[model samples]
Target: MIFTVQIKVMPLKDLLDPQGKAVMGGLQNLGLNNVSDVRIGKHIDLQIEAENREAAIATAEEAAKKLLANPVMEVYEITVS
Candidate 1:
């Protein structure tokens, strides 16, 4: 069976996101004052071959941990369908 997987990778809350800050500053300069903050992240989509949803999720978890997300400064969430 094949599963569709979605992965969201983001900077840790306690960490400083320079890219996000830069975007926020740009937004403020553009007169978009209503937006208080901004954060940048990554979205990864994968087509995984597995026997079941659980198996697909596990594969995604390992991939996220090993390569996709940096555990020191980033966190990742995985969804399988």
Candidate 2:
């Protein structure tokens, strides 16, 4: 079976996100002061070949942990469909 994997990679909450901060600054400059603590993250989409949904989820989780996200600075969430 073929599975669709969706992964979201984001900076750890305790870590500083320069890109997000830059965007937030830009937004505030544009007079969007109501928005606060903006965060930016990466979305990854890929197809995986697996025997079942459970296997596909496991594969994607492993991929996220091993290659897609940096454990030190980033956290990842995986969804398989």
Candidate 3:
């Protein structure tokens, strides 16, 4: 069967996200002071053919680890539907 896989890739909390910070600064400039912080990340969707949800998640996780996300600086979450 085919599964819909979603992966969220984000910079580690301990690491600084320049893009997020830049956006935050822009927001502040626009008078959006209520927003205290921002974090930028990537959302990836994949259609995977697998026997089960678990297998689909595994495949998406491998894709996240190998190419989608940089493990040294980022973390990823995988969900299968």
Please list the residue runs of candidate 3 whose C-alpha ends up more than 4 Å from where it truly belongs after superposition: none
How do the residues 1-81 of candidate 1 rate in per-residue lDDT, one tens digit apiece? 999999999999999999999999999999999997699999999999999999999999999999999999999999875
Q: Which ten residues in a row have the lowest lDDT in candidate 3?
A: 53-62
Query: What local lDDT does model 2 show for residue 41?
Result: 89
**Residue ranges of candidate 2 with Cα displaced over 4 Å:** none
lDDT against the true structure, per candidate, is: 0.94, 0.93, 0.91
Error of 3 at 6 (Å): 0.5
Ranking by lDDT: 1, 2, 3
Deviation of model 2 at 2, angstroms: 1.1
TM-score of 2: 0.92
Model 1 compared with the native: what TM-score? 0.95
